[model samples]
Target: MNDPIVKVEKLSHRYSVQWAIRDIDFEITKNGIYGLLGSNGAGKSTTMNIMCGVLKQTAGNVFIRGINIRDNPVEAKRHIGFLPQKPPLHVDLTVEEYLRYCARLRHIPKQEIEKAITDVMGRCAITHFRKRLIRNLSGGYQQRVGIAQAIIHNPEFVVLDEPTNGLDPNQILEIRKLVKEIAEERTIILSTHILSEVQATCDHIRMIEQGRVVFAGTVDEFDNYIIPNTLIVTMISMPPADELRSIPGIAGVEELGGPKYRLKFTDGQDVKERIIETSVARGWRLTEIFAEKSSLDAIFAELSKK
Candidate 1:
């Protein structure tokens, strides 16, 4: 039976004196697209490699459907298919030959190999390019082949590292579509530092900062959870940071100098209106007040910025 659950408990990794990832824990239940988000070198790849058994973590463990990766590597690995940032492809092999070879490598039964190849090709939208040599295809087509290879074994969990790292905008869109289509039946772990791509395609997010998880939550929850207290206030006159802190819903204020101020407020209060009304009653001249919308890009920068 295919079970699509992955759990990482107290996951940690180090390189000599440098710590790459530390004390990260999260769980994936059921099937959906998950994005592991962080800035470059924040350890997204390190964690993914540990999960795939490519690099051994100095401590902690990963579980695939309750099977510990260290305890039962073969059985645990059989349930996972991984595509690293740079895909391994043979330049001379046609798309058809390449997929057939991948099937053999995964030890797919000879009798079912043809059906597996055809299905993965169709899912990746590479059936039209089946006869073209891998080297001859565009980056977009090559990426499709990489994805097809990962799924050809029909693994329950597919891990893709920076699947759209170098493609043009149109190619990125196509890959996102293919990722969504693939996630319908199996779980996927998408590791990337790019925010726009994750915002457009991921269902859940695990935000890694300096090799540790700063946040783990659903996409919707993350936006609301992180942004409820963030706002921008542009005014001709501003109150003292201490006075502004006393306003309902207003938890903290940072003076950006000149005409700009950043405000942090909790939900459940009309923070903007209260600020405006209070300013008017005090005869403080105002110009503009705006709430900064939460975007994956901005949120990631805030969490990972030094």
Candidate 2:
């Protein structure tokens, strides 16, 4: 495999007495979307800042395309594009103007700045709003403009910090589509608190909690961290809680009000069939019987506890 587009090793950052991030290590491969998930104040912003050269790391190193950011800030940064939670839009300027400014700042050749701006505007789906002042455009359009600026120079890596924050459902979907479209040939690190966004857009995920990486792997790997080989059986006519607990291979049962029970099974047990058979034998109606797969929410809650 090719070397990672972005490499972080033992990265640490602190704010005075409080440690915002501690000894985190991860890599962003080429041409894939990586989700950085965490709850509020989970040091996600701090980590992104350090990786993008916006903040100094207390320890560890950040390399962009094999170039250490600290050793060669300019060259390393040329390969990266960043859009913060709040886009740094000049509300007074038109979308085209703003993108032109970004192209110049990124050191695109003077002759190619116009063409670069045009291309990024189209790519980000802001071509229709190119002449509109950012202040006058809708929230979704503003976000498109922000992304346009981020990719104006065609960087190999794009980092977006909560790009969908503060948008309506429609706008969120639009932005999600835009992120996916842009990720076809570039590495994208999407940092957001919305787990659903990660589920929808990311190929792999790294879950951060209170300044540490608690989970890192594909979505399937994260889901596997939750209870394994467990099934949830809901019945409308469940026996008395204690009687339900007596079934074979039944390790435990949680009563969830009015004939509803969650049954846990022992390893290598076909508890579902037994529950169905017992219900049928007793002439009790089984309202719902199905296997339950672990959701990302359950996995995140479990990891956050650590």
Candidate 3:
């Protein structure tokens, strides 16, 4: 059987008198983008630093493809790539020069270094800026270069901390596209507090709040964490509030003043189907009916409380 790509067990960290993260755990077993979601200072960076072997944990262990990171960091790190919050960039050097230097740091042989640099630059869409000094590149291109450095070694797992923290909206979209492309062949850990980042880029999420794993699951699961209790229905000919409440699944009816009504339902109720069927039978003329989904911001706030 193949080993899981990454496994974090009972991870904890502390700074002097305060604990930053405690008893956190999760696993990655495939090649896709997984988000390490949390607010600022919510221990996202601390956790990624430990997983990539940049910082030692106060307790627990991290494994990369079944190899213990602390016991054999070199071997474990060979399978891992990391781009911290502030990218480790040398702004004075040209893009190609910087990538070449990174390739050397990863210990690629001299014979294959050029091909490695060329391939990575192409993949990152920065081939045109090869000779451009890093400092001259825009924030978006610089971010692309940062991503390029992280994956220069083609590691199986990559950790990216807030890769889009300061870029404008267009740049954020570009970086997100780039990250998705990179994940097609390798597993990526996208650590960020941005709700949309996770919704748009991640296949799975592990949300942290106040130094703990408040929620962990697929994006759909996270979004549906709180089952919607109300649904909105609009009709050309609306029924009386008490008449609508007489339906089997509906617990209460709230008249929304116009042709709209709000329905409250108990758990395990098929309210929509019942409402539609009743509307048709009673000739109420149902025009629109759909459940109102909880917003990501609401879910984030809710999870943080736990």
Candidate 4:
């Protein structure tokens, strides 16, 4: 098995009298997108900052490609590209100029600087804006420029904090596609509060709360953690709640709206056929009746309880 491209163990960070993050741990394998999910002020940024060597951790260690960041900061950093919550952009420079500068800063060979800039710009789909001043571009285009700088070095690992924070639906889709394409060869760690973003883009998810990882696994694992034996059933025809409750295997039911209900069931039972039979016996007009797995939003809410 290939070693993890990024490993963070027992990581902790403090701010004067406060602990921003505590004992966080996770790993990222090559060529996969890992989602870091948490609410605001949940230490998502602090953890990302520490991983990129932008902020010092009060305790613990971060390793990139088997190199300890604390012992060899420069070498460790050379293998990482980080985009913070607010992307750092030089508004005065055009996209091409800024990227060329980044390539130089990343120490790409002088002879390869131009080619690196051109390649990354094209990879991020910002080639059209190469000659445009960054300040003059739309937020989406500016974001693409940020991405271009992050990947210009062809780092083995990329850490992006809220990459799709402020974009319309179309722009969000475009950036998501860009991140997916980039993950083909490099490890991408994405941190976001947007549950849909994880569901749409991540192969695995790690959910943190109060500076500690509460859950870490694939999307299916996260969903199962919160909703082990649950199903949502919606019907266009209104049925009496009490009568619906009489079904044998149903453990509980909650009315969601005028004609919707969320049903919980005991383990080792399939309730769909029973629900159908009940509807038929009562002569109820059942427009729709199907079981649904809980969504990521539901899972997050369930996991973040007091």
lDDT of 3 by residue, 240-260 (tens): 888988887788788888898
68-98, model 1: which lDDT tens digit per residue? 9988888888889999999988879999999
TM-score of 3: 0.94
Model 1, poorest ten-residue lDDT window?
221-230
Clashing pairs in 3: none
Q: Per-residue lDDT for 113 in model 4?
A: 92
Each prediction's total of clashing residue pairs, residues at least 3 apart in sequence or on different chains, is 0, 0, 0, 0
Worst-scoring 10-residue span by lDDT in model 3: 267-276
Q: Write the per-residue lDDT of candidate 4 for residues 1-306, one digit (tens) a residue.
A: 365798899999899989988998887765799999999998899998888988889999999998899889889989999888788999999998899888888989999998898899889888888898999998888888888889899999999999999999999999999999999988999999999999899989888888899889998788676545655666766777787778878888889887778777774355777887887788766667655666677788777764
RMSD of 2: 2.8
The runs of at least 3 residues in candidate 4 whose Cα sits more than 4 Å from the true structure, single-residue gaps closed, are 228-243, 251-263, 267-289
User: RMSD in angstroms, candidate 3?
Assistant: 1.8
Residue-level lDDT tens digits of model 2 in 159-215: 999999999999999999999999998999999988899988998888889999998
Candidate 3 whole-model C-alpha lDDT, 0 to 1: 0.91
Ranking by TM-score: 3, 2, 4, 1
